[model samples]
Target: MGFKFDWFMKGMLGAVLLAFLWPEPGAKGGFLQPELLNKLGVALVFFLNGLALSLASMKDGALRWRVHLLVQCSTFLLFPLLGVALLWGSAGWMAAPLQIGFFYLCALPSTVSSSVALTIAARGNVAAAVFNATLSSLIGVLLTPLWMAWVLHQSGGNFAVGPVIVDLLLWVVLPLVLGQFSRPLLKDWASRHKGLLQKVDRITILLLVYTSFADTVKEGVWSRYNPLLLLQTVAGCALLFLLVLALTQWGARLLGMPRGDRIASVFCGSKKTLASGVPMAHLIFGANPAIGLILLPIMIYHPLQLLAGGMLAQRWSSAEAAPS
Candidate 1:
């Protein structure tokens, strides 16, 4: 009935349909060329993301600086540190490429659209959500590469940070800036067509996932990972999500933040953007097909974060309305 449940069901149904329709992993010939389809899908996704973003709403100065700081620290700092620790602990057991993927996932930015959506759904500070989400994207362009380079260097892998930054500018930053600039003209139109825009967003994300998964299947990358290891990685992701959610919520409360700001902090701080993460993966790990395999953890985590945050937001809203 609710949008959250409806979307979750759609995602699950889509994933199922994809798995069944394209059962064979490496069979390439399909309805369309995968590369072109992927590029088109990604473009549409970013465009809708741009439309959904309200730069007008971003001017609100209601954010508690302390809460914002804590969100950034958790998203950019603490998460990566935990990833590094995981890599170290799993060094003897896990494959090198998978380890790199783990680290890469940790370095990604906080999600923009979903974070804002969840925050708003939770009756949180939407403007603060936008600010932090935007800041995370800008910060991620630089920080993700640096963190990746550091991890790779330690692991005796060769990575060029300069090229990565250049690619990021071309692929992520430029488009984002263009979207921001174009928002003024499109904002009113987009508001009137919110349902259409949401449809576009969902379709775009589904296509992106389909292509990325197709690529991984075509490369036989999934074969490298055993079912048990895959299960463990998924379990690890769940635990990490819970830990971050708890930590962010606790940190926000400790900072004496209002309910709205606390919700924004928890939603924005705890989640990573698959939309951003997928594009970055295509740029960074494109040469090594195995690298795409690393994004699986993030893909699994993204939808779960949305569903969980949606439920939590509803609960919080009810609690707030109750007479004490």
Candidate 2:
């Protein structure tokens, strides 16, 4: 709960460095055949998620309609609009694909693990955090693509939602549904090996990040930019996170949410899932040369959200524990 640096975020940075150094193995047509591995790993990630999901936990959180509405709207609706406004306001500041990356960042769902963890750390409504985070991921499988397709079309790029949705159903939803169906038989094992399953999730995501950045490097996407560009991206991502964080808290207060629900809303509503975003980017963008550039905002935002949310959680926890 204290502001400790997360090793997984460290691993994410290490993955990018590896990709920047030796991109061949993870790049397309490389020895690893990353395209095939990507597809499999992505499906496996979601399948394991379905297996781990507890219906009882979700149900306990499901009845809080007001909390759920606020969280979901903040995640899906508020963030994307912010992306649009940023894109409009910045006009010629960056290239089109990079701008699209910012939009893609906004369009992603709330993260599952960190949001729930931070909520628990802050003595928030963990049940609602779990429900809203999981629901956002599922909804994002559909909405993210639709949002992307519309944006790409507006920019004169072709992104066919129909084909992408069908592919997602096969690789994402089908595996998830199958895992859920098999849960009755395997839930006990999953619970017992929770740490192992979580490692699997992180490994898959790391692999995706490596391959994605590797592809970008192989295509010389980074050559067009400099260190200042990354700094600019970090600043932009930080600003976006702060705005969403403030707005979610404001909305929760306006609704007169309890302390726990407010904590859950602020944490869950403000997160963007690196887990879902990376895999979905690979699926949606499909080997576009600028893939790494497209993911830059999200990769940056992931750690920023964690650090900020973790600090806030610790402060809130201490405040709650203090004698009144």
Candidate 3:
């Protein structure tokens, strides 16, 4: 409960190291270069996501408009703003790659599993957590790209808007909608196999990581980063997370959301998902070696959020009654 190993996270760590050493397995024209395999994996991630969603839960959760709006805005709006502020504050400190990566981190969606788990631990609105977290992933498929594209365009970085939207719709939304449409047929099977299915999602993410890093390592990208820079990146991720966590808590209370919903806002709004991030990055950036660097902040943030959120949940749960 305190610090858990997200298999996908561990896989991503392994992937970077492996890419650094060999770079063949995950590289283009290699056995694991992705190609059609990557598309299938991403599609499967969202398909399973759709299968796991409960329409009734989403409906009920949506009715809490204030809570829902707060969480979504905190995630999509506030997080990006904080990232920009951090970029400004660290102007001389952070490199361009790190800055871009950090900005991407801000644009990511909340983690569905960890957010909901922490919400339950904190005695928050778990149903709302589920609804909002799931909704965030769906929203992220569209929003993250738009933000990234606009930012990159403003900065004169390369961005292909048309292809990005096409890829997202094909790999993310399309599969998701298909799964939702077929949920009535697969609901019982999905429910029973939830544990296994979740593993599948992790494995798919791991595959994406391998391909992403493989692409990067081939370019000798790791040569640029030293231990000091790595440590600073971690520090940057921690600072961004802590600041957003504090802000979400304050905003939730100010919005007059109830205690249960506030916990969900704080937990879900504060998290960024490696599961969704890695694959989406690969999809968006396509094996750019800098992706390993791009994913760096998120890789560090994943565990920090888990550990920090767990500690906060333990404290928050004691203050409120567990939901029915």
Which one is best on TM-score? 2
Per-residue lDDT for 1-324 in model 1, tens only? 023556744774575357445734422454656545554555556556655666566668344687679888998898999898889888788766667777787899998877888777778888889888877876887888888888888888888877877766765666666766778798888889988877777666665556666666666777876767777777778887898888888899899998888888898899897777876776676556564467767876776787788788888878877899
C-alpha lDDT of candidate 2 relative to the true structure? 0.90
* lDDT winner between candidates 2 and 3: 2
Error (Å) of candidate 1 at residue 131 is 2.3
Model 3: lDDT of residue 211:
74
Give residue 188's lDDT in candidate 3 (0 to 100): 93
Comparing 2 with 3 on TM-score, the higher-scoring candidate is 2
Model 3: runs farther than 4 Å from truth? 6-8, 321-324
Identify the superior model by TM-score, candidate 1 or candidate 3.
3
Locate the minimum summed-lDDT window of 10 residues in model 1: 19-28
lDDT of 2 at 130: 93
Candidate 3 per-residue lDDT over residues 65-125, each given as its tens digit: 7778888998899998888787778777677778889999999998898999999888889
Q: After superposition, how far is residue 118 of candidate 1 from its true place, in Å?
A: 3.1
In order, how many clashes per candidate? Answer: 0, 0, 1
TM-score of 1: 0.85
1 or 3, greater by lDDT: 3
Off by over 4 Å in 2: none
Ordered by TM-score, highest first, the candidates read 2, 3, 1
TM-score of every candidate relative to the true structure: 0.85, 0.97, 0.94
Off by over 4 Å in 1: 1-44
- lDDT score of residue 241 within candidate 2: 92
